[model samples]
Target: MKVLIKLFATFRNERFKQEEKELPEGTTIRQVVAQLEIAEEALGMVMVNGRHAPLESQLHEGDTLALFPLVGGG
Candidate 1:
């Protein structure tokens, strides 16, 4: 399956801001995160096709996945 991935904030450092990726069928959001080497604790939000999704959510072809890193401020 082919899906579009969007990275936001510090997550984009050393990585692409947006790109289309070829993922195997039955892939889950959590798998993609690991593939990108993104630590679970550092993730702030996960979205699929503009809707919030859980880490175990299954991704389909043409899906758009967006990853955002946790934001911290005083």
Candidate 2:
């Protein structure tokens, strides 16, 4: 299955802004994140095709996955 991945905020540092990836069928959001070397606790939000999804959410072909890192502000 092919999916588009988008990284936001600090997650983009030393990483790509977005890219298309060919993942195995039944790949979960957590699996992709792990593959990217991103810690689960470091994520602030996860989205699939613009809808909020959980880490255990399974990805589908042509799905758009977006990842946001935890942010801190005054």
Candidate 3:
């Protein structure tokens, strides 16, 4: 399966802002994050095809996955 991955905030420093990746049929969000070398604790929000998604959510071909890092402000 192929999915589009979008990284936000500081996460883009580690990975591309957006890119397409080919993964196994049963690949999950956590697997993709792990492959990107992103720490679990750094993840803030996850979205799949415009809907909120969990780390365990399974990915599908043509799906768009967006990841954001926790942000802090005064």
Q: By TM-score, who's the top model here? A: 1
Q: What is the TM-score of each candidate against the true structure?
A: 0.98, 0.96, 0.95
Give the Cα RMSD of candidate 1.
0.4
lDDT per residue (tens digit) for residues 2-67 in model 2? 999999988899999999999999999999999999999899989999999999999999999999
lDDT of 1 by residue, 1-74 (tens): 99999999998899999999999999999999999999999999999999999999999999999999999999
| TM-score of decoy 2 | 0.96
Clash tally, candidates in order: 0, 0, 0
Pull out the clashing pairs in model 3. Answer: none
Q: Rank candidates, lDDT, best first.
A: 1, 2, 3
Tell me the whole-model lDDT of each prediction, alpha carbons only.
0.98, 0.95, 0.94
Task: Give the range of the ten consecutive residues with the poorest summed lDDT in model 1.
Answer: 9-18
- Residues 27-61 of candidate 3 have per-residue lDDT tens digits of 99999999999999999899999999999999999
Q: What C-alpha lDDT, on a 0 to 100 scale, does residue 26 get in candidate 2?
A: 98
Better of 1 and 2 by TM-score: 1
